[model samples]
Target: MDVAARLIGSVRLPGAAALVTGAPHGAPAGRLALRRGDRLEVYGVAELFADAPRPEAAFPAPWPGWDRGVDAVAPDGSFAVFSGQRAVRAVAADGRALWEHRHGCWGPVVGHPHTGDEQEVCGGLEHGSVHVPADGRSVWAHVVDADGPEHWVVLDARDGRETARFPLEDSAASGSHQFSLPGGGTVLLCVGMGQDGVLLYGADGAGTPDGTGPSGVRDLGEDLDRILLDVHPDRPVYLTVEHSCDDLRVHAPDGTVLAGRDAAELGEDRCWDYAAGFADADTVVAVAENGEDDGPGHWLLDAHSLAVLGPVAYPHPVTGSLRALGDGTWLTHDRATDTLSRWRRAGA
Candidate 1:
C-alpha cells in the first residue's frame, strides 16, 4: 500500500541542525523547537505552516562555542540547560548562569583535570545528554562521574541542586540521549556503546526539593540495542528503533513492548532507520531503506498496533528523517538546501 504526502509548507532555517518537542502531554501542543547553531528557535505549529515568520523567540546556548554535550531549552524558552564536560549549567537568555552543578568530566582522558577550556575537551570522543521536563522546574542529565561511572541525575531547575541520582551499570558509553516522558518528572536515557550495543534506562522522580523522595532508576533490560525515539502525544508510550535497524517498537513508560514491526516485513534487505516518530495520536511516520533503493523509503504505521499501513509517497524527493511535530504533521530536513519542510497526509 502507498499513502500520498502533501507538502503543507517549508521554512529555511540556516544552520538548523536538530528538532525537539515537549513532553507528549505537555501544554501548548502546537509549539515546536529547533536547534539552530548555538541557539534554539521556537515556533508555533500554525506559524510554520502559514506565515513562516521569524521564530517566536530564540535562546542562546549556555555553552556558545562548544557543541560536544547535548542541551535542552525550557518548555517556555526562558532558559536552557547545558550538559557540559564538567558540569551542567542552566543559563538564561541574557547569558546569566542561573545555576551550575559540577560533575566528572565526560572526556575519555583519565584525571585530565578540566581547566574550563572548551577547546581542551572539544577533542573528547564521548559525551552525554540533558533534558527539561514539561513543568520546566527540573533538569535531568546523564553524565560521567569522577569515579568513572555514568549516572542519571535530577537537578532543581531553580538552584541547580542535585535532587536525586543513580549510577548506571553500563560503562562503555560512547554517548547517550535523554527523553522526558509525558507526565513531566519521568525520563528515559539511551546510551550508545560504539559497536557493542545500546543501553536504556528510566529515571523516576517528582523533582523533590529535599533531595529525597520516590526517586530511582529502572534498567529497561540488558544486552539491549533499542534507541528511544519519540513518545505518544496523548499517552505515556514511546517509540524506539532497534540499533541495527532490525525493527521498530512502541513501548510503555515502564519499558514494556506494546507493539513491534520487523524490517523483514517492509521488504527484502530493508532496515528501519534510527529515526521514527508519532505524527499524531494514531499514526507514525517511519523510514525504511532497502538495499535496492536509491534513498530512504518513508512509511506510515498504525500507532497503536505498529502495523504497516503503507509507504509514504512524497510529491517530491525528500532526504533524511522526519521529525513529528505532534500536531498532526511531520517535518523533513534537506541538508543540501538547509530547508525544513513540513508535510501531512494528502486530503487529511
Candidate 2:
C-alpha cells in the first residue's frame, strides 16, 4: 500500500506537555482527546479539526483515580462518563454529575485457604470502564467488585439507572475494555489481565448469559499479554488483538485466529505498539516505533487476507498510535509539537 498522510488541521492544547491517550474511540464527536498535566482537559474531534477548534470542556485530573485510564464522551459532546476507583459518574459538559454508581473497593478481602482469619488485599481500579454507545442513550460500565463477582452493566445515559447487567466469567479480572459495533446493537467487552478473554453482550436492554441475546465468552488464553484493539462495527464477529506489541492477530469471537502477523515477521526492529486496530472492515493498521528513531510509523494489512500492505508515510513524526475515524481518515498526535492532526489517503 502506497499511503500518504496530509495534515488537514492541528491544535495546541493547554498543558505543561501532551499525554496522548491513544486515539479516542466510541465517541460520535470525532476522536476524543484527553490531555493531562496541571489538570485534565477533554476535547472533541470537532474541537481539534474544525476551522476554529476549541476545547469542549475541562475537568480536574486524577478524578479520584481513573481506572485503566479509560473513559468515554457522548457523541454529541453533551456528557462524559468517568470511572474512578470505586465509582463511575456521568458528568455533563458543565461538570455536573448526571448520575453516579459506586461499587465495592477494587481490592477484595480474602480469607486464608486454611485459616479463617481475614487477609487484607488491594488491587486498585484497573479493570473498570465506562463506554457510551453510538446511540448516545446508554452507558456501558464494567464494574469490578472486590467483594463479589464483577459485572458489565448498561445504564441509561440520562439517568444512570441500571437497565441490564451481565456477570463476567472472570471475577478476578484486573481491567476491562469495551468496543461498540458500528450500527449500535452489540458491544464486545474484553476483560483484561487474569481472564484475558472477550465477552459478547447485546446492546439492547436484555443482557443475558445463557447463550441468549447473542452473548458468549471466549478465552484468549492464559499468561499472554493481549489487548482487544477494535471490533468491526459492521462485522462484530471479527476483532483485533494486540499481544504485547509482539503481533496483531485478527480473530473470530470464538478465539480463533483467522490471520495475523508478528512484528518480527514484518521486518520491524521492535514489537508493534498497542496503538493498532481495524482501520475499516477490510483494512487493519498497525504502528511501531520507527527504527530510525523518527517517532512512530504504521503498517497496513489486508484485514481478510492478513497480508502486509506496506508502511504508511506520515509527514510528521507520530508520537501516539493511529486511531481510525471509521470514515477514510485517521488521527495522530504529535507530542513534540503538542498538536493533533488528521490524515487521510493521499488524495482521499
Candidate 3:
C-alpha cells in the first residue's frame, strides 16, 4: 500500500525564481513549460529524464503586451499560444505573430443586480488562462463578450480560426482548467470565484455534430468550499478538494459524486492540497500537511475506489506542486535547488 518515486532526470533552469507550467495534452509528450523572468522555455520530458537534461526551445513570454496569464507551447515546439486581457495570440518561435483573436475588455463596469451600484467585474482569464490540448490542432479559450456573456471558443492552432464556440452560464470572472478525454475531446471546467460555482463545457473532436456545448453546470452548495483539482487522464471523472482541503472527492462531468474521503476518516488530520490531481487514469496523487513544521507529505489514492494507498516519502522533499505527465510519471520543481525533476513510480 506504499508508493515510491525515483529521480529519473533533472534540469537546472536559469533565474532564482521560476514557474513550471505542466505540459498540456497536445504538446510533445515529455515537454514542460518553464517560465523564468519574462521568458518561457519548453524542455523535453525525455531529456529531463535522461542522464543529462537540456531545454528543447526557449523564447520570451508570449502575449507581451499586457499581463501574461494562461499560455501553452505548440507540440512541435515551433510556436506558442498566449492569453492577454481580452485576446489570445499564437506566436512563432522567432517571436513573430502568427495570429491573434481579441475579445471584449475583461473588467467592464456593470450595475449590481440588487444593489443598484456600479462595480467593475472581470472574468477568470484576466488572471488565469486558456488550454491547448494534446493533438495540437486547436486552442480552447474562454472569452467574455462585450455585453457580458461568456463563451468558450476553440481556435485552430495553425491560424487561430474559430472552429467551435459554446456559450457558458453567466458567472463572475474566475480561473479555468481543462482535461482531455479519451478521444481527442476535452472537458473545460471554469471556477467562478465570486459566484461560487463550477461550469463544465464539452467539445468533441473536429468531426462530431454540435460538438461544442454546455455539458453540465453546478453550484456547489455554500456549505462546501470546493476547488477543482485535476481531471482523470483517461476517463470522464475529475478531482476536487472540498471544505478547504478537509476532504477529497471524485466527480463525474455531470456533477455526480463518485467517491470521496474526509481527512479524519483517513486516519490523519491532514489537509489535501487542491493543486494535486490524477497521476494516471486510476490513481490520484495529492499532498497533505498535518499542521507540523515537517514539510508536506504526498498521498496516493485509488481514483475509482477512493482508497488511500498510504503515504509516499520521496527520496527528496517535493517543494512544489505535483503534475502528472499523463504517462505513469509526474513532474516536480524544487525551487530551493532550481531543478526540474521527472519522477516515475519505482519499478513503474
Candidate 4:
C-alpha cells in the first residue's frame, strides 16, 4: 500500500489542548476538538443535533482556578481536567459534575477513571470521596478525612453525590489508559513504578468472575506506558501504542500478542489511533509520530514483521488523543495547526 501523508486541514483554535473523538466515519463527528484561549471552548459534537451549539455537555466549571489545563478526555466521554497539585476533575458527559478528586497512588500510579455516560464519571476524590447512588440519589458517601485508599465510588448524576465506594485492592495510578468498557467496566494501564502491569475492573455481573460477585478483575502482567483501549462492545481487547523501548504489542484477553513491533526509539504511549489504528483485531498499524514529513514517516511497516507497506508523511505532529472508529480514517491531533485531523489508511 502506498502511504500518502499530509495535513487534512489546519484548525484555527488557540488556548489549551483539545480532547478529540472522531465521528462514526472517522470524520469529526461527536464534537469538534477545540482550544479556548486557555480554557476549553465549547465545540461539542452534539451541536449538530441541536441548535446554536449547545453541547449536550459542557464543563460548567472553569478549568481549576490553579491548574495548567485539561490534561485528558476520558474514553467514557468525560474530561480528565487538571486541578493543581495532582487533582483532577472527572466531569460527566450529561453536562453534570460527576466527581472532583485527586490521585491516590504514592509515586507513579495511573489513576484516571472515565465516565461511561452523561450520567456518572469516576476518579480519586479528595477529602476521601465515596457515596453509592440508589434510585437516582447518592445512597451515602464516606467522606475520606484524608487521602488514603479512596475507593472508586459510584455516584448520583444530578448533584455530584456519592452512592457506594469500595477500596481498590491495588493503588496503581491512572495513566493515559484510564477508560470505561462498554459495560461500565474500568480499565487501567497500571504502570506502578515498582510493580507495574495492566489491570481491568468490570461491574460485578452474572457472567463475571464468581469471587468478585458483580465486579470483574484481571491482571495482564507487563509494564506499559501508553495503550488505546477499544471498549466498543464490537471490539474489546485493545490496540496500543506500547512504550517500552519503542515497541508496540497488541494483545488479546488471553494475553496473546496478536501483533508486535519494536521501535529503535520510543514514541508517545498516548498516540493517535484514528480509525482505531491500522491494526484491527487482526491487523496492526504500528507508526511513530516523529517522522520527517507526515506521520507514517518514510515507511509504513507491518506491525508484526516491520514489512514496508510504503512511506507516510504528515504536515504536522499528532497530539492530544487518538480514537479508532474502525472505518478507514483516524481522529488525530495535528499540533502544528492544532486541528482535529484524520488519516485515511484502509481505502484512501
Candidate 5:
C-alpha cells in the first residue's frame, strides 16, 4: 500500500541548513534550533509549526566560518560551543566569552609555523565537529592536532576543562559531525575523510554499566563507509546508509545489524540516499533515486522488519532530502526559496 504524506506546516528560513530538535538534556522540550551560517535561531516547536514563526532567542557562534568547524547550541539556547582549528570555545548568546580550550591546529600543511595567537587561518583542508550530550554537562569534541592523531575529548561544559580524551586513529580531510543519542548517555561520531571513506565511533557517558565516568570509544567498523542518519527516538537502535548509497540498515547499540534493505529491494536501478532516517518509532522514511535523469523518490518502510511499505505520496512536489523528526513527522528544505517544511502521514 502507498503511504501518503500531508503537509503539516512549513516556514521560510533563509540559509537554514537544518532544524535542531531539543532533547531532554539539550534544548527545552518545546524549543527548536534553526542553524544558519554562524548562528542559531531558537523557536518554539509548536509555534514554528503553527504558522506563527518567531525567534525566541538568537545564539551567535564563535570565530572561523561554518566550513571550518562543527559547533553546537546549548540546551537552553544560552550559548554555543564552536570546535575550531586551534581551539574549542564557548560563547554566550550575547557574544560574551565563556571559556576556551586551546589545542594544535587542524591545518593540513605539515610543520605549519605557529607564528602568534593573532595569526588566523580561514580555510583549511581538515577540520572537526562537536556535540553536547543530553545531560548537557560536557561537550564531546573531535579535534585534530598538528603533531599527532585526531582525538575525541570530553570538556567540562562550565569551565572548558578536559575531563577525558581519546585518539580517533583516523585522518579526517573533510571534517566530522557528532550525534547525541536521545538519553544523553551515549553519542555517535561520524568523520568524513574525503575520498578515503568515513569513520564511525560510539561512546557512553556518565551512567555507565559500572558507574564509571565515560566508556572508552568503540569504532563501528565501517568498511563500507556507513553514514549514520538517525537513532530511534526512544531506543538505541540507529539508521545508517552505505557510503555508496546502496543500502539502509538499522543497527543495535552494540553495532549489530537489526534489519536492512538494499536497492534491489527498493526498486530496479534505484539506490538509497544517505539522508534517510526514522520518521517515527515504527516507520522509516527514505529517499531512493534512479540516476540524475529521474526525480528523487521517497519511500516508507517498516522500521522493525525493514519491509518496503510503499512510497510516500506528497500532495505536491517536495525537494531535498527527508529529515525525520521521529515523531510521525519529517522535514525538507527547499534550497531555491530557502523554505523549511514539516510533513506527516496523511490522515495520520
Candidate 6:
C-alpha cells in the first residue's frame, strides 16, 4: 500500500449525447463536437466560462481519435482523421501547421499473414502520425510505408521530412497502436506476434524488442492471461496487471521484474474480471469496481507493485479508459458514450 485518497471531486458531461474521441481543451477544460453515428455535435468540457459548451461556428465530417494530437488542444482545434477512407481534415480551434514527416518504404513485413496485416485496409493511416503541438507552427510526424506500415519515424513536425525512422522486419509489428511519452518522444507498440515478438520503439526511434529483456518475455508468458497495455513516458517500467487478484507486475527495460504484488482479494470484488489502468512514467494507478452489487468501487494500486493502498467511493459508476493528468486528477473516458469525465483524487 503506497498511497490513498482523502477527498475527491467528480463531474460529468452536460448533454446526454454519446461521445467520440475529439479534441480536449487541456487547460481550463473546454470541449468540442463529439462524434456520434454519422455526424458531429458539440459538447462542453468542465466550465470554460459561466457560459461554456457553446455551439461550434463551422463544422466538418466527424472522426474518432482525430484530436488525439499530443497538444491537448489541436491546432485550430482540428486534426486529420482517417474515417476508414481518406484523411479528412477539419478545424475547431485556431489551426496551424508545425513540422510533419512521412515514411518511405513499408519494408520487409508486408504479406505476413499471422500478424493480422490483411485486416488493415489500404489507403488508411497505416503507419504515420501528424503531431501538432502547443505551438501552432511546429508539427512533427512519422509516416511508414505499406509493407511494414507500423514502423516508427521521428521527423520535423512542420514539414513531412524524415528526421529518422525505425522499421519492424517481423510480422507482428503493426501500426494503429502508439503510446505517447512525457517528452516529445513516443513508444510505438509494435507487436512481434507469432515469431516476430513484442517491441518498444524508444525515444531514439529504434525498435528494441521486449523479449530480449534480462528476465525474458517467455518467463511471464504462461503466467499471463491478459495484457492491458498503457504507457507513462517518465517511467522506465512497462506496465501490466495479472489476471489473478489483478496481481500487479512491473517489468524493467531489459525484462526484469521491477515490482509485483498480490492484493488482498475482496469476497466477490475481483480485478481478474474487470480493472482499468492509467499512468505516468513511474506509476500506474488501477481502479476496480469492487462491490458485489455492481456498485461503483475504488482502489488505488502502485503502478509498479500490485500493492493496494487507497480505497474510496465514486460519485458515478466507473467505466472505460482513464487518463491520469497527475495532481490526483483523472480523466475517465466512457467506452459506451465516448465522453470524458474528470475525477479528482480525494485529497488530504
> Which pairs clash in the backbone of model 5?
25-134, 26-75
TM-score preference between candidates 2 and 3, better one: 3
Query: Which stretches in model 5 have alpha-carbon errors above 4 Å?
Result: 17-31, 49-52, 64-67, 114-119, 207-213
TM-score of every prediction relative to native: 0.91, 0.74, 0.78, 0.54, 0.89, 0.54
| Residue range 1-348, candidate 2, lDDT tens digits | 557767776666544133234324245444554645422355555556666666656654335433244677787777778766567777776667778887655554432122322222244545477787777777778886645678877777778777666776554666666776555555666665543543333344233222233234334544345577777636754545555567777765545677777778766576687676666667777777646756667777777876888888777555556676555556666666766676765665
* Candidate of highest lDDT: 1
lDDT, each prediction = 0.76, 0.61, 0.63, 0.38, 0.74, 0.39
Ten-residue stretch with the least lDDT total in model 2? 111-120
| lDDT per residue as tens, model 4, 15-92 | 323344421101122343333333333454334223234433344433333222223333233442323223334454
Tell me the deviation in Å of residue 261 in model 1.
0.5
What is the alpha-carbon lDDT of model 2 when measured against the actual structure?
A: 0.61
Across 144-179, the per-residue lDDT of candidate 5 in tens digits comes to 676757888888888887888888776564777777
Steric collisions counted per model:
0, 4, 6, 39, 2, 37
Local error of candidate 1 at 348, Å?
1.6
Model 2 clashing residue pairs (backbone): 28-75, 127-174, 127-175, 182-233
Any idea how many clashes model 6 has? Answer: 37
lDDT by residue for model 1 (1-348), tens: 789999878777664436522122122346666566776566676675554466776666666666666677787778777777778888787778898888887767766665666434545668887887777777778888887888888788889888877778665778777777777656778888879888888767574545763366777755567887887888888999888989999988778889999999987899998768989999999888887647888899999999999999888887577778666788888878877788898878
Q: Cα deviation of 149 in candidate 1 (Å)?
A: 1.4
Listed per candidate, the RMSD to the true structure in angstroms reads 2.9, 5.9, 5.7, 9.1, 3.3, 8.6
Weakest ten-residue segment in model 4 by summed lDDT: 126-135
